[model samples]
Target: MSQLLDVIVAEDNIVQSAYLARLIENLGYRALTVEDGKAALDLVQDSGAQILISDYQMPYLNGVELTQAIRDLDLDHYVHVILITGMDEDEIRSNALAAGADDFLPKGHNPTALKARLRAATRLVQHSKQLAEQHRILKEANDRINDDLNAAANAQRQLLPDIHTEVLGTQIASAFVPSAVVSGDMFGCFPLTDTLIGFYAVDVSGHGIHASLLSVAIGHLITPDFFARVVLKGQEQPAPANLARDLNARFSRSENDDYFTMFCGVLNSQTGRLDFCQAAYPSPVYIGPHGNAQTVGDGGFPIGMFPDLTYENDHMTFDKGGLLVLCSDAAHEAENTQNQAFGSERLEKVIKTSHRIETDGIPEKIVEALSVWRDRIPLEDDLTVVAFRRT
Candidate 1:
């Protein structure tokens, strides 16, 4: 196809239309001449023609009428319309534009002015086409990412326990809510042996897919069988401190440098004694029969920071009728509409008020209180909470 024929010249006078066609050819574009606007519009529809050069007065449809018809045609490609007319009043130009003409030119075109206008029109057509292609590519990419996130979210949900359950001698209750499609927070409880129950919570360093994947990877790697592996190696079961250091050495990297903050604990079912380690995670809260909530452990460095860093284990007892709560940082960092951190203080208060509720309802109650304090504010981070009471 000749680049020149992308244009159609329409005029009621055959001589004028013929002259315009030749001028378009001289300008290096292929052109077609029609003696009226109606015929010119037909050519545009048939040829996917992009440019219309039509006189304001024609036997059938006039220039403005043709421009409006083209606009209403719903063609995939945009058409650029330039009206030619004897009138030069501002009102006429305004009406022509309102009628859908892209631009207007006085009849009997001067070579220099016509050349600049036509070239500019050509540039705009090309630019619009380019923008349309970019939009298409962007939509395709967005759809794929959304689909991937949906699948990842489902897999992440599968790695968690029921909303409430019992593990050995402890009544365990939990909640998990991701701020987005996937969460960086994870927690679990499993029987390490006939007398040992293991519990852990970790928040991988950030939100979304990368952090969620790392969090889930850690979850899968640590389990009841994991403790059994330590015994298979002919070594005593490691303390929570030893486990944290071991994980740090495995996950630490010089590039991208993925890491997490963690809390790990093992409960002796027979004695109701808890040995736990903290790695810069939020302190777990203890609520006993006295109806008060107190923090359990001192904070330490985050895991996977210094590969060889040593960790400290904290000791606590969860007698029957007592609640031990471990949560991701999101629990304390939740903000209210007043722009205040949900803070350790607020969490402690919530625990004390709800400690009298059933163990299974405690985490849910905290979530409900947080929802009210935010006053319609959306969660700004992934939220996870785990609590257990010796029965």
Candidate 2:
């Protein structure tokens, strides 16, 4: 940003060199003079001169040869080289530019004309430095943003359950897809007992890092013996439905007015009982041994909506070889540009139609149904599907 011009003059003719150096000094700059092209090159290297003015014809090294050498050294400072030529030959002009001279000055040109060219070169140096500075700043900002996004993604991944574990005598398989650099969808697994597993899939309001952060908050509440105390505590004979109502009260105190829809359940492997609570989330589907499918439980208000709202629980009996499928609303509500939701009805038909109910097949069939419905449109929100089957 400083307006200081340090120039180097290289002319074999001693008198002409002194005159040019004097002219540069009069323009409020520091001028350096060398008698030959070699000395000019050496002085510019050590002094970091901003501009170089040299005579075309010199002994040992010509002005064009010297310009090429300057470029080969890869000097950091912007050296605006002006080649002074006595001849008006087109060959000399072309060769000067090819050798890396920025401008050409004829010998007959007056001091006034030569001064104008130097002024132009000074402006170019200032502008070039400014552009280089801007490029560095932009790259630094982009790197910081990428680093922050990667950290958020790592935290989001930790919220997911271990798919390789056997819990509650069921094999659990899951798939989570976040629409952006960060997502708001959450899923967790906690062992209620050696033979029982507690799991929940939640969708926080909004998207990106904000939604992902909220999922972490909900994970904090899914404690051990969560069902007996949070769901069935104090009720000498508490129904699964009654337990869900109690949890609704405990989670309703979030500061934000936005709601988080969740599907929570305790699966008892010994008795094949799936005690479930759904609040404004899609119901989990049960695929029978014969492939007959039915949706379980009635849904209540989403958590974090009302501080005093009540929730109801629903119960379902699953036989051996039955599969339970649960997903967020994003799975059903995903649409193409046409604005038509994939809908639960179509989702149900897909499950019942597919005779192959393998562990991986559950999520695959649902995604296939959505892909067809959305016409291959990109997912607009977080999409999650969890499938559990009795071994």
Candidate 3:
């Protein structure tokens, strides 16, 4: 032991107490003599002693009663109680143990037995202290990790466009629900020119911190300046295929396995022309002016996988009073308790029913439908929906 262990001895006989105290000191421990069980408990409580040796008969409290009282105290350290008794009956031993006595010793000056018991008690107390210290450190580390995750989640939310926004006469509405504190999903709608509106919905390969980091990076990179410089070809309108190819080239690396699905588009508000590229993302639903729903986009390769893959551009029309919805796979692939998916048919039906409602309330209806399908179970993946309506 690095330091001396303090042991409390409670006995009414002054001679016996002195004898026990001398034996304790001789065994490389500090002895604290008390005349009664009450005094012994006070000494242990005040000194935070780890060992208590008490005679069965005392002035105020018996050894068994004292052990029970010590066990009830909310002290930070454990006190190993050893009852000294003259009787060797099984009933007495059972009663002492039942009252929280850790060990029992015959009422005599047997230094050998006392020394053995003290060594065992010291080992147990040390183990308990080590465990408490380790628990404190782990709790602090967990709290710090939670705080960082919350901060990152908040910053990612700030990158999202408002729930209801207008860009160049186009009414845009969006909804995002993350399964965890951080998400693998991101989307944005911004104007590229006075007559051109650019938008994108991205889902990183996996969920959690790594996926969220990539999504945030993509959100920061897909600005108007980026579209004018890289996505557009010298005074020409921005090409969706060029944006997909550039992202694939920038993110693909041999050292790491990271890829994402993207739906990138540039809509010409004046001509109602929508040029888009779908990189393995879910096909978007296009609702016509007469409320007829149809799907768009020919599925292409996922970005950031192969180094020299080519993506092609597809086109559609966003005419007056028509609605276009882009959703991540989570919205349709969500499962019920029976393990059945909320497939594309159900998703299209929900959008069709909400067509008469304002564009701002459409995404909420879709989210509510998914929530009811899951029966209140937590989402397994991130869910995101972006809708566009031409007035």
Candidate 4:
């Protein structure tokens, strides 16, 4: 149900105030009559009145003074002021208007003009109420969306591996930073056998909810059980290329162009034999114990894009005291206030010196270096890094 329209009549003349009040009540609005402008203002403030009909001459406060005072009040709704006067002077009308009078009524009190002004005031007040209601609804909806995004982000973080751990004699450390509340990057490291360990990094095609959904799905799909069934061959070493091939076949769709990049590696703990497949992911930096750094991997097709894509397996030796650093594209593409990219050269340089630092701290060191290069600005994309050191 709608609220009643309140019209406050402020006139010192008892006969005139009674007439105006009767007319207002006839128009189906509640009219409150007051003997002076001061009393009218009190009524307006108390009742949240949106229409004020005031006389030009009154005790304590006149019509113009009352209009200005009403305007000064920090009321939520707008008050439509109609100033009534007997004089025909232009200065009087101008003063009333300058003092915030929205309309004017002759002292003779014509019912037709009064009715028209009240109708207009009713329409305006109703419109304002509608707009306020709409703003409230939008705010509630936005709050709900933010809550859902935060919950999903927490779930995504749970899918990631620990920050630092040891698996199959290799010291492993990782870091992940999302550009938004949710991320499109995911990674994991797990022991495939008593002597073999597997690690992989994945970055979906874009940012926000769509990409984050796919990244989370990939995280669940690439578990150790899935690797055992699909990637590991009987009595032979696991082939990362086969995993890449399977992912490509599973996610590729003709309806949409969504896809992701991945870098998968299987390392033999005793021999330090590293077998890897890079699917359009950033080439990893291989740092020798003496700080010599070189990039690994030849570019291959991004997964979930093309069908029948052949992925090649690459091999390298993970010598003792050697450090292998893998990162998402955000590592090198992060830009400073000057818009200069941190670049692959800087990335290699940072990792090259990691041999001097503890293996568990290398991932954080890389992130800190990138933050400095970007001048502490938020990253434009998700940043992820996984580091492995042969002890």
Candidates' C-alpha lDDT: 0.82, 0.77, 0.89, 0.89
Error of 1 at 20 (Å): 6.2
lDDT of 1 by residue, 1-391 (tens): 2344378888878788777777788888878778877898899899877888888888788788888888889888888999986655677677789988987778777766667778988888888878889988999999999999999898888888777999886899999989899999988788888888887889988888889989999888887687445422353543777678778878875456688999888888878888888998889889986766789898888887766788887777777788888778887888887788889888888888888889999988888888888885768889898879888
Predicted structure 2: lDDT: 0.77
Which clashing pairs does model 4 show? none
Q: Candidate 2: give its CA RMSD in angstroms.
A: 6.1
lDDT of 3: 0.89
Could you tell me the lDDT of residue 164 within candidate 4? 91
- Estimated TM-score per prediction? 0.78, 0.69, 0.82, 0.82
Model 3 over residues 1-391: C-alpha lDDT tens digits?
Answer: 7899899999999999999999999999999999998898899889988889999889788888888889889677778898887765678778889988998888777989988888888888899889889989998999999999999999999999999999988999999999899999989888877888888899998888989999999988888778656666673655788888999999986458889999989999999999899999999999998999999887999999888899988888888899999989998899999999999999999999989999999998999999999998878889899889998
Query: What is the full ranking by TM-score, best candidate first?
Result: 4, 3, 1, 2
Measured with C-alpha atoms, the lDDT of residue 310 in candidate 4 is 95
Which segments of candidate 4 are over 4 A away from where they belong? 8-19, 32-48, 51-110, 353-355, 372-376
* Model 2: per-residue Cα lDDT at residue 291: 88
Ranking by lDDT: 4, 3, 1, 2
Model 2 lDDT-worst window of ten: 235-244
Give one digit per residue, the lDDT tens place, for model 2 in 166-247: 6766878787888887778888776765766677788988877778777766665565565556655674333444444555
